[model samples]
Target: MNIDHNDEAIVIVGSGAGGGTLAYELTKRGLPVVVIEAGGYLRNEDYVNDEWEAFNQMAWLDPRTTSGSWRIARDFPNLPAWIVKAVGGTTTHWSGATPRFKAHEFAARSTYGRVDGANLLDWPLTLAELEPYYDKAEIAMGSTHTHGRKPLPANNNYKVFANGAERVGYKHYSTGPYATNAEEYDGRPASIQDGFNFQGDKNKSKWSTLVREIPRAEATGLLDLRPDSQVVQITHDPTGRADAVLYLDKDGNLQRQAAKLVAVAANSIETPRLLLMSGSPMFPNGLANSSGQVGRNYMRHTTGSVYARFDQPVRMYRGETMAGVIADESRHDPDRGFAGGYYLETISLGPAFLASFAAPGAWGREFTEIMEAYSRTAGLWIVGEDMPQESNRVTLNTSVTDKNGLPVPNVHFDDHPNDTAMRDHGYRQAEVLYEAVGSTGSHRTPPYPATHNLGTSRMSARPEDGVVDKWGRTHDVPNLFISDGSVFTTGAAANPTLTIVALAIRQAEYIADELRVGGI
Candidate 1:
């Protein structure tokens, strides 16, 4: 498994929260690393003031180019799934709602009993075990919200919801920690509360993983970042260990990069796709697919939106996409007749183009009236937990191919009955809050596609049920690891960026320890 240069380096596939954090941790410990990102580098100045343009620049927009994109399915017709392919990945456009999964979330199956047709399992690690890493990730990302800190300022939106939740006897409080700058902890500039809107000039800042960790990794002189390199496959040796990677350069020229340890941080979809594509006699099903679980257990938090037209302007466009969150209904309580949890948050309604799509009205004069009334309206996003089902999986589509001639991932997924029930509970609760806020009109938005996809390459204690072990090491391939949301065993009812960063940090320590002991 020797290469021309015979260089030994840790190769990471993506530069999102997981990959970037891993690179930072490993390089800080004086380990050499190579990070490959499919998108080019972008700065804060590149972010514009138009929501549509900002979304396009921050995410994968085109349908054709993203035909084989992760979670963008042809099977589910009206669902809108958003994914990013840039250097910083989807973190560039993330709403920055950083909430830690509850302690019970790790043991949902054991606590709430078995979910039919679902693979609900407790996490190998507990929340207490990962709390330190969460704190580190939050500090590193300059998270602004005061969740585990002192009393936070209650915005008008938060007060309205909290008051309503208390009146209804729901145990609601503000625990939604955001990954934005609260104060100048790092060398970066302090957060300006005035510029909280997604497309406002004041919202500009360098807060992404690329902006934080990649620069530090580069300064270490042990990490090499190669943007615009699309990884095609992982090349393995006769012993079934990943030795190198085949990728297409920016100019579309095929090239190879050798490494001793390969970290597949290519998100949930692309990671499995890459592994399945790297087929050989030793791994005919796919690399590390002996258990046939490389792309199983796919899960995403089912999201619902509650729109309300208040008598007075709620000033929806004044702050970040996610400025406040409600956690009263976000804990799993089996006595509630549902097997999942949900969280509520106040989000911005972008300008005309984006707002029309999110809050669309029927055609004719009604549509015009709804559009005119949007100036006095605001809404809340209800994100509910979806149980991990083995039937909801991501397998290769032999019949479908991408522009690069690679087989696209076939995503077969549907909501569980419990998930729908949880959503209904959230919707009803949201209606109560909206009515309490003196809303003239209120309606629940239809179920749309979720961006927080997880559990394609889950982590378990044994290889019989997961692609990676508790430490995220591949079962079949030693020296190969996975560090991303794909490794989640259960999908918690919260945003996953902070959790992914914590896992990456923990994985880096494990890899570092193994390297020190000459153990793969």
Candidate 2:
């Protein structure tokens, strides 16, 4: 049944790890949900395995601008982020590494004690508070090496990475905490060892909101899923509560959906863009920008890559793209010349991507030489906590409008000193690891356009400090919420997808209870 435009229904935006999971959780509990996605739906059978072809089919290639001193500006000026715009969102393109946030990471401000040039804040809650939800999320996602799920087999790339890690004296290296299955669980089949995991898993072994949460939510018959609908504005009543959302359908016609409760999970950049665009007389600054913090404090985790060439043929791109993780460095030791630590995970890209990302603009000999050594190469990615700065932010660039004539978000970022230190350390350590296991040479690649965009509409303990509260409810608008990584207080050293899913699960429980008691 169609949810009428006048009916007060539960509405969610986007369909990624957060919004898609929240949709399933709420619908499974007998609540009706309407999910409006900005892109068209592409099923598992619809995925294209070729890297560049798949990228073109799924990437959010909208008109966006990038600024500040980040290398991405020089390399990919119009593509600030490499997120997917399809119905499942970026979850369709993630690497499937699901590491939990460490306990100390939740209390970063209290533990680190005031680093200069950082907007550090302790999470309103703690790891202990979220552990149970993490467990639930893990079980729901069928995370390997957790709750009786078996880990995926090690590929040649992981074998090489593990040997190097072992020679370097790293203790905690593993094939898991990954979300792909080694054996069938929860009706999804085991991995067929496909290297196209990054291009949307056609085999359905990897976990994505598209493969799991969305289908389950649809099965409940309580979901109204509308793809290719871009939300433009959230209209509010005179009492300052969100009442409706106005969006453009696939036909470019505007439609309004009345919402009793609205949850925005449109990733970090667009979530705030929508909120900022919704400014009215009641909320002159933005919907939840009473604290003037709607689009401030943007973070894309500190990232880079190290690829080494060896004498033997590793053929790294023969199995899962990112199945191995080295957790020994994922700690908070200031002795490492940085405030936080990083993870070194095995990664293997197709030859086309390897050439493109190995060196953005290199010449004939050096570039071709690297491509020629593809079979003999092994690589890993460095992902660490990047300090959030109030200056690094997403703002409206009215000069460049999107296809629908809306101002696109301009992402401005400058690497924090801590981020630089951590990246340098990661590079040195990766080189050492490769050398210890016999590498001829290694190349350090600058960060790609961000996939882990986070923290634009952060959560705070007090209303004056942030946009949302501990429950993800906007401090200025009670019925409005943010159910994505945009609400991250601090980006922990681990990946954000698992945490995003866990938070959505926890948020769903709270929202469901509030709905029952008429609390909103």
Best by lDDT, which number?
2
Alpha-carbon RMSD of each model? 3.2, 1.4
Superposed Cα deviation of residue 295, candidate 1 (Å): 1.4
lDDT of 2 by residue, 156-275 (tens): 999989998999899999998888989998889999997888988999998899999999999999999999999999989989989988889898888889899999999999999999
* Per-model lDDT: 0.75, 0.92
Count of clashes, each model? 2, 0
Clash pairs of candidate 1?
196-319, 196-320
Please provide, for model 1 over 92-204, each residue's C-alpha lDDT reduced to its tens digit, 9 standing for 90 to 100: 76777778889998877777787777788887878889988888887777666543432234555666666766777777566357766555456665456543334322343
Off by over 4 Å in 1: 1-6, 61-80, 145-156, 194-206, 353-356, 359-362
Worst 10 residues of 2 by lDDT: 1-10
Clashing pairs in 2: none
lDDT of 2: 0.92
